[model samples]
Every structure is written in C-alpha cells, then in structure tokens.
Target: MSQEGWEASSMVSLAAWLEKHKEQLIATAVQQLSDREPLRQHAAGPVRWFFDSLITAIKDNQQERLETILRHWVSMCRIPIDGEPVGLLPVLGVFKRALWARLQANPPDENPLEFAVQLDTVIGQAAEFLSKVEAAALLDEMSHRLTAQAQTSAALANSTKDHFVSVAAHELKTPLTVIEGYSNMLKMELPEATNPRAALMVQGIESGISRLRGLIEDLIDVSLIEMSLLNLELQPVWLRRLLDIAAFEAGDTVKQRKLILDVKRDTFPAQPIIGDPERLLQAIQKILANAIKYTPDGGRIAVAAREINKFIDITITDSGIGIAPENLDRIFEKFSVVGDLGLHSSGKTKFKGGGAGLGLVIAKGIVEAHGGTIWAASPGYDEEQCPGSAFHMMLPLRDVKSGEGMAPAVATAIGSLANAVLERDSVEKSPQKATSEAPAESEQKETPLPVPVVPSKNDHNKDQTKKGGTEGGEKS
Candidate 1:
C-alpha cells in the first residue's frame, strides 16, 4: 500500500477505537470527578461535564457544539497541552481537510462520519498529554513549597535559641554576684563561732550560695558554648590532686544526702598531666553532682580513674535513673535531662530539684575542648533490676617528665591566689582591740566646731531689745 493509504487506514482504526471505548472513557471521567483524593478528583467534574456535552453533540451531529464543548473542557480542566490548549477547532479542521483530500483521491464524495471519528481521536490524544503535563507541574510546585517551609522552620528555631541565651545571661549575673558576696562574708565572719545553731545557719547559707553560684556558672557556660566563645586555660596538672580536691568539695553534699561516694584512685598517675585543670575539675564535678542529685539516698556513686596507654579514663557510675534506649543519644544535648524510663531509680524526677539541664552540656563541651571524649551509657530501664547510668570521660595523657617544668608554676599561682583571697577575707572580718598607740575611735567620730562671727549693729540691737523689754519691770 502507498504511505498515504497506510496513514489513512491508521487514522480510521484510531477513530473506530475511540467510538467503541467512548462509554468507558466517560465512566473514567465520572470516576475522576467523584473521587475524594484531590489530585485524582481534580479532573473528574470537568471531564464528566465535557464528555456529557460531547455525547449530546455526537447524537445531534452538531459540529459547532462539539467544538465548543471540547474547547471549554480543555480550559476548565486547566490541563497543560504543549504550553496551551490544543484548540479542538484547529484539530477538527485538520481532520476535515485530510478526510476531504482522501475522499477526493478515492470516492466521489467525502464521508462525514469518518472525518468526525478522526477528529475525536485527535482530541483524545491532546487531552491525555495535557493531563500529564498538569500533574507534573503541580508536583514540582508542591516540592518547592515544602523545601522552603523546612528552611524557614530551621531558621526560626536557631533564632529562638540565640534569644534565650542572651536573655538568660543577663538574668543570671546579678543573682550570682550577690550569692558570691554573701558566701564570702559568711566564710570570713563566722569561722570560729561556737554555737551549733550559728554553725548550722552559716553552713546552710554557704550551701545555698554555692548551689546558686553553680547554677549561674552553668548558665554562663551554656551561653559561652552557644556563642562558640568557650576558651580553655590549658596547663599541666596532677589528675589525682584535682580529683581529690573535687571529691573533698563534693563530699559535703554527698554526706548531707547520705549517699555513698567511692573514689577509686588506683588508675590515676602519681605525676601531673598537661590539660586545663579548672575545666577538668568542672567537668568531673558536673558528672559527680548529677550522680549525687539523681541517685537515691542509699544509692552508691563510684568515681574511678585509670591511665590507659596514652589517655586517662575517668568514669562516674551511679545506680540512679537510667535512660530509655531512644533517649540515650539525646541525653548530652543542651537543656536535655533524663526523662522517666518507667523505672523509678531515685523515686524522683531527674531534673525536677535544681537543674536547668546545662550540666551535661557544659561537661561535654569542657571534655571536648581539652581534646577528650565523653559519653553516657545505660543498661536500659528495668524496675526489677536497679537501673543505672554511667558517664565516661577520656583525656589524652602527656609525659609527666616533660610537663614537670610548667606544673609547679601553675600550681603555685593557683594556690597563692586561693590563699590570698582567704587571708584578705579573714583580715576584713576579724575584730581588733583598741590600743593607746592607735588613734582614738572618738577622735575619728568628732565633728568640726562652727566658727564664731561678730554680730552686726542691727543684729545686736535686735538681741538687746528683747532682753531690755523682759528686764524692764525688774531692773527699773
């Protein structure tokens, strides 16, 4: 067959297929319209209405009505077919011209039925292409919107965190200064008080002040960490001595809580290690304090240190409130505390007493700043077995001999400053007896006398007139 004859036959076959499936196509349109899901249902109403009108036009053999209905359908469906609607009139004209040419070459007159069938086939293909384009464009728009929303949300979260840090810093500074001042005053003034009540009151005041100071310091550390301004004062220092001091200072609280604190010193080095002593002590204190705070009154907290090859490993293990498996990774995050894991380890909430949830955050920061690593481990939560949490801190070690040159100076400076502050406070509070060689306290209190002045003639006359008038009856 000739190429033109083959093309004509293919168009006739497509037109016949459309005619046979027209009812099925209309049902699909109705299904799409009545469906509840938005994407699927978007095409349903316009498709059904267009098909109903097309069926009416076909029955009436109204070509203009069929063209108008197809155009209205494309516009109402909002389907994109090659950037614009494939207007039914242009497509129908093409089919009409092709059919007329075919008829002229073959039979005496054109077949109108065959021409209508070809036009329907062309319109169907155009509608399918438009639907697919519309779906793709909708999906692309949704993806862009979702990505923009996620970025906006993340930006808002970071901004809120920054604002909180700024406000918390200013709020904490004033209270911290007042607490430190009163603690200094009490330490100086009540060193030798004999009364038990006075001693107890002083101890309570000091303890309260210390707790307040710790809270403020934690806030400051958090703010510093958030701002990325945490600076470490690195130097060589004896791990054993540092641990001993921390243990001693923390002992008071442990004893008051009636909790057992076992410090295992076998693993520590006899000589100093090179690192920031103050930050190391703060990190250790944070861990120990957490253990003491969360553990029950009778629970035990063990602090063990070991020197392993090139690192010093310190572990604080407590049979306190253990973490859930899901929460383990989040425990070290800022403002994160151990949530209830169904097992009442201490019979109290982990951070309800006196925690802003910044201890672990600061602890982790200090350990990392010192070129060390820290992690928390728990054996899950089980009520039958005592659930516990363990915090491990590992610091890289330096040769004791190499670090010896700088250790003494750092230790001396730290000790001397501590002693000087103590001594100055003592001198200010101690009462001194008055001595003859010393200036009299009364002389210090004396007020300067007013200078005498000669009275003017008018003032003297006024003073004499009052005296003379009273004395007139007696002196006359």
Candidate 2:
C-alpha cells in the first residue's frame, strides 16, 4: 500500500467515479444506518462535500490534505448530528460496494488490483475520520443531557419547597384567625384603663399576632405567585384611594415615629385606574411599610403620585438607611436580606426593624403582572447621615393592549372619533322637546348617524388611512 504503487491516473479515475455517483452514495449511506432518522435531506450537503474533498485529497497525496477536508465536514454536520447516522462504517461500505462493482463490470486500463487498493485505502481513511467525529458527538450529547437533568432536578426541588410553604401557611392561617378573634374578645371584655397591665399585655399580643399574620400572608402570596394562581379582582381603583389605605395601614407606625407624611396626589379628583384594588393597596402598603421600618425616628417620608404620559409614578421617598450597593440588584428576590452594614460601618448608626424580606418581592410580582415595573434607588448604604431610599412603582395609566400604542396621527384620529361620539350623545341629551311625536312615514325617512371616516391607504405606508370608519363604510 505504498503511495507510489497507487498510480495518480488510477486515483483520478476513482475520484471521478465517486463524483458521478455522489447522490446515490449519500442515499445508500443513510439507508445503511440501523438507528437513525431518514436523513436523506441532511445527508446531501455532507455527502457532496465528502466526495469533493476526497477527490482533492487523492489528487494531492504529497501532503495530508484529507485531514483538513474531514475536519471541515465534521464541523458542518455536527450541529445537526442528532438525526445523522452513527454507523459510518456501513455507509463507507457503500463506496466499497460501488468500487468493486464498477471494477468487475468494466475493468480499469491501469491494473485493476492496484487501482482498487488505492481507492480502498482512501475509503478506509474516510471511515476512520467519520468514526472519530461520531465519538465526539456522543460525548457532546451526553454532556447536554447531564446539564438538562441537573436543571430539571433543581426546578423540581424548588416546586416541592413552594408546595410545602403553601400547605403550612394555609394550615396555620386557621389558628391565627382564632387567636385574632380571642384577642379582640379580650379587648372588648376588659376596659382599656381599668387594668393598665392587662391592656398593655393585650396590645403586645395584638402586635405580635399582626406581625405573624403579615409573614403568613407573604408566604401565601409567594406560593400563589410561584404556582401562577395569583389572580386579580380587576376594577377601576382610585390611585389616591389605594395610597390612602396604605397610609392608614402604616398610621400607628407613622405616629409612633413622628414621620412627616408628604402626600402629593394627582390634581384631578377621582383619578381612577383599572386594577385589583386590594392587591394593589397591599403592594403600596408593603413598600411604605418597608420605608417606615428601616427609616429612623421622625424621618420624613414623602409619598407622591404624578401623571407621566401613559404611566403614573407612585414614588415613596424616605430619609432612612438606604439599601446596600451589592444587594440592590437582587432586592426583589424572594426572602432576600442584607446584613446590617451600618453596624460594621463606624460612622453610620444601625438601621431599625427587621422583616421576612418578602414584601418587596411580592410587590414586584404584583406590579409586573399589572404590566408595570417596580424599582428602588438609593444614594448608598450608610454612606451619609441619612442615605435615603426612593421606591418607584411605575404603572400604566390605562391598559396596554396590543396596537394601542400608535403614532401621533393615529392617536389623534382616535381622539377625534371619540369626541364625535361624545358630541352625538350631547346633542341627544339636550332637552329638545317636540310638540308631537314624528309620524311613522317621517321617522322612516330619518338620516342615519354619522361615523368618523378613515382615509384610503397609500402604497408606501399602509398605516396611513383615508377618512373612513374603523369598521369601514360608516359601520355598515
């Protein structure tokens, strides 16, 4: 099998033979695999390249050019290798079969035996290259499967944890309800001033129960959110009304800390937006509660709402210890907490109050579900005497339906149409009384109501409409 014995002329004939039957070779090769999809479609590109490369390699045996060709073929085919055949030996056998049959039917002008030997050597080399690629593919596939399995296991573990939390929280809720009822009964049975010690004990009990109830509610919310079962009772909720509820929830705390509430609401009265009132109020309460908890005594917390185009920014700013720089990014993560960095920082005072750290997480989830965003900004953790935090909940003033955000011309057209409807209604509502009802014949001849028209479309831009109704032809 010396290179010299394999004549260049014979090699050229073999290469020519392969090129001529390249298609048949690919079909026959794909069919040879016992465990593979019908890869006739995928096999064509690799098969064509293989033959072309083989011919080049045979023509230039002075250097090992076949290795470069084989490397390229492997790279192209590996991405789609899942459906490709693994038993490349059987495929290469198709080439051997073709070679032997061709020689038997029409003997070569050069020595048949020598020509066949050189062709067999190249074919064997191709099979070797394919085997190496197949092995690499197997290893790569195994790695991907292992990674997928790991991810699935982690997800299952988290699902189990959420389930346990949900069940435990639900069970404890009944007992908590009973305990709350007993505390209320005791308060009613004993007068506030009659037994000072008893009154104080009852108040302490109520506070502890309230704190526990908040934690349990957070657990329930997190579990529901994780399970995709957190549904909203959507309605037109006044933003100020919700803020007022939140302020009331923190009223006692505000008074205790002497917090100066800077409440600036929208100038427009009854500024209503569609949302789940209870859940939205809860989100606001949680963020405000966080400000009340972490902020120092007598710290001024300013809660403001202003219309900003399509969105309303309900922001809570507090002159308190701000969040740690590192923890700011992951503040919304469930059960996320930061160490008391002020305790370690010599110049800063220790921040007050600790929480279960699920409030902001639940708030974020609620805001996002409303097609909005919640974000926190701060100067730095314990950087100044009172490094403040500003929590902004940006809510869309109206529902963000698809295609609602149109160009200025389109929005103006919509507004004009709305005004036309209002104008029609106003005309109908005016106390214009007729002495007698219209006769049947005259009523039948009455004109149809007018509808705003959209303009005809242009070739360059379809969105540009002619003056015509949205439904076309005056809603006919």
Candidate 3:
C-alpha cells in the first residue's frame, strides 16, 4: 500500500475506536478530574462536556466543537478552585494524559505511533488556535478587569479601616469611661486604712483599666500609622535622656524578675538629636518592655548606643527565648505574636506570655516616622537552650524627609487621649514620685558588666561568613 493509503486507513481506525469507546473516554476524564481535591466539587459536568465535545470534533474533522469547549474551560479558569486559581493548560493536560493511557491500552491499529501523532496534532492545533483567538482578548480583559477590581477592593478596604477605627474608638471609650468613673467612686469609698483588701481590689481594677487603655492607644496608633496620620513635634532632644527614661521605666520589672538591665551609658552619645521626645520615649519603652516580656527571670538585658555615620544606633540584647529565624522581621508586623496562643500565659511581663502584639509594630512606626530603621537578629528560637536575640534601632541625628505629619485635628485628638491616660495614672502614682523612685530601684538591679556593642555592617558580614553565611536581618 502507498504511504497516503496507510495514513487514511490509520485515521479511519482512530475515528472508529474513539466512537466505539466514547462513554469510556468521557468517564476516564471525569475520574481524573474527580481525583483532584479542588476539581472534585464540580468535576462531572465540565469533564463530560469537554470529552464529548473533543470526541465529536475528532469524528467530524472540524475545530468548532473542540474550540467552544476549550474556550469554556478558559473562561472557567478565571473562577478560583478553593480560593486558588485553576489554569486551562493544567486541566487540558489531564485529559491528554488520560487519552494517551487509553490509546496505549487499546491501540486502534498495528501502527500505534501514527495514531499517537494524530492525537498530538489534534491537541496541538487546538492549543495553537486558542493562542491565536484568546491570547490577545485574555490579556486585554485581564489588564482592564483585574486592575479595576483591585482598585475597587483597595478603596473598600481603606474605607473599612477608617470606619472600623472610628467605631472601635467610640464604642470602647463609652464602657471604659463608665468603668473608670465607678471604680474611682468605689476606691474613694473604701479607704486603704479601713479596708486594705478593698483598696488592693481597686488597684487591680485600675491596673486592668490601664492595660485596656494601652491597648486602645496601640490600636489607634496602628490605624494612624497605616493612614500616615502619626503626629510628631520634631525638636532637638537628647537620646541619652530618652534611653535613661526607658531603662528607668523598666526598673520595676527588672527588680521584680531579679534581671540585670545593663544600660551602657558610656557608649551613648552626649549630643542631642532632632525628634519627638514623648513619641520616641514611647518607642524605646515598648522595645524594652518586649525584651522584658520574653526574657526569663534572672536573665540579662543590655542596652547600648553608638553613633554610626550620621545615625545613632541603639542596640538592645536580651538573654531570652530567641525569635525563630523566619519570625525576626515578622515580629514587627501588627498582631504577629510568636509562640502557641493557647499555651501563652495572660500576664504581659510573664515569660512567653500573650499580648496584642502591637508593641513592635507601633515601635517600628514611630522609629520610621523619625526617618530611621529597626530590625532584630537571633540564633533562632529555643526555649530550653536560650540562645537569645538582639534588636537594633538606627535613628538619624538630623531631620530627614519623612512623609507628611498628622493632620492638626488628628494630632489634637491623639494628644487629648494620651493626656486622659496620664491624668488618670497620676491619681495612683504621681509623676514626680515615679521618676524619683525609678533611679533608686534601677541602681539596685542594674548590673555592672561589659556590654557588647552591636557590630558594624562589615563586621556583621564577616561574622555571617564565618558562621556559614546565614542572613540575620532585613536590609535597612
């Protein structure tokens, strides 16, 4: 027989085989689709349609039927499978594999290679035609459609954030005000000398209120940070004094834990820098508080500072349960508390305790607002071994061009809120007494030890190289 005759015979046999086992081929495709977890939900209808259309196209020797089904599949790809996108090629590839398996099991004729060639040609042609017809349209639609959808989503999210912040603030303030008023009246009625236990109960209530207020402030700060509305009053400020205040603020916790808080004052620059005094103090205090929270009892925490280039780098090293390698940067993200939420204790200063996880996030915001950067480093997380972690905060000595400051109204609102907290706190412990007592308490717990300064970039790289080149932090 001539080569042309053989080809014709092969094509005729292929069509007969396909028609004879039409239901089987469709069933095979359906089975394959059903095996995939994402496809299992709506597998039967689409798989049947695809295989039926494909077999019809093959028998008729026309592209129209196959093209329609392929187009349907392409459109279906836009709909996600279990929140993840489904791709047309992958779905089509599944049918191709199933068809190949069927052909292998029962070859149409003696020349199986020819039948295989024909099958390839059919699938290849379908793909090529799809490229020609759908590629440009898909790109055009995706460019316009996806862009518009993303913009709408982002606008909605921003509006929701603002609405949530306003609603949360208003809702929280009402209950907190009522609780505070009632607690104050109760405290006045129960004098310490007459009822010591009642006085302690009032103190506990006040402490809880303070913590709740702190949480509210943190949430407000985060919202402001996200919206680029953090208020700042930049001025020449001594960073040494700020560090001293932070260390002093942490003195009570240090004494309670019998932990050594070594504030390396000698390395700290005597010169002043441009920043918001209250805000910067808050940032430093948050970082110190975080260190205290994670560090175990009797562990050492060292605070050191040095001028590097035009920036002042403040380094805080803690002998604590170190952060995991992956969580070093993630720790600064909002509500990014590490450790098992269920296992973590409720006390804020307790080892491996639970928190709202906004301290580092707020600290990062305040530091960045002053045109600075912050990051952390650790060997890795190990509760038993206690490898430890270090945080570095680099602040510029001169004012750098940070983005817009908060609106006057927003600033005023935040100021009033903070003032309310301070005024209430003063009713318990006067500012003068707190300041006077801090230094004395710190002097008792402050350990006189050689503080290890943070390494420079070059030195850090060299150390990393020596230790098999593991990256310890994100680039500033």
Candidates in order: C-alpha RMSD to true structure: 23.5, 14.6, 18.2
* lDDT tens digits by residue: candidate 3, 1-476: 01221244454666777777767776776666555655655676677666667766666655566677667667664433444555556556677787788888877756678788877777777767666556766788899999999999998997897679757965897799799999999999998999999999999999999889778878888888877898776533556666656776678879998899998877876644556666777788888888888899999999998889989899999999999989988999877889889988898888776799999999999999989999999999988888999999998776311212433443444355446556656854766765664456655573322111122223312342222111111111
- Model 3 ranges with Cα > 4 A deviation: 1-162, 399-476
Model 2: per-residue lDDT, tens digit, 197-224?
8888899999889778877988999887
**TM-score of each model, paired residue for residue:** 0.53, 0.58, 0.56
- In TM-score terms, candidate 2 sits at 0.58
**After superposition, which runs of candidate 1 have C-alpha atoms over 4 Å from their true positions?**
1-144, 147-151, 175-209, 307-309, 340-352, 400-476
1 versus 3: better lDDT goes to: 3
Count clashing residue pairs in model 3: 0
Ranked by TM-score, top first: 2, 3, 1
TM-score of 1: 0.53
lDDT of 3 at 378: 97
Which lDDT values do the candidates have, in the order given?
0.60, 0.67, 0.72
| Superposed Cα deviation of residue 98, candidate 1 (Å) | 15
Give the top-scoring candidate (TM-score): 2
For model 1, what is the error of residue 409's alpha carbon versus the real structure, in angstroms, after optimal superposition?
9.2
Q: Who wins the lDDT comparison?
A: 3
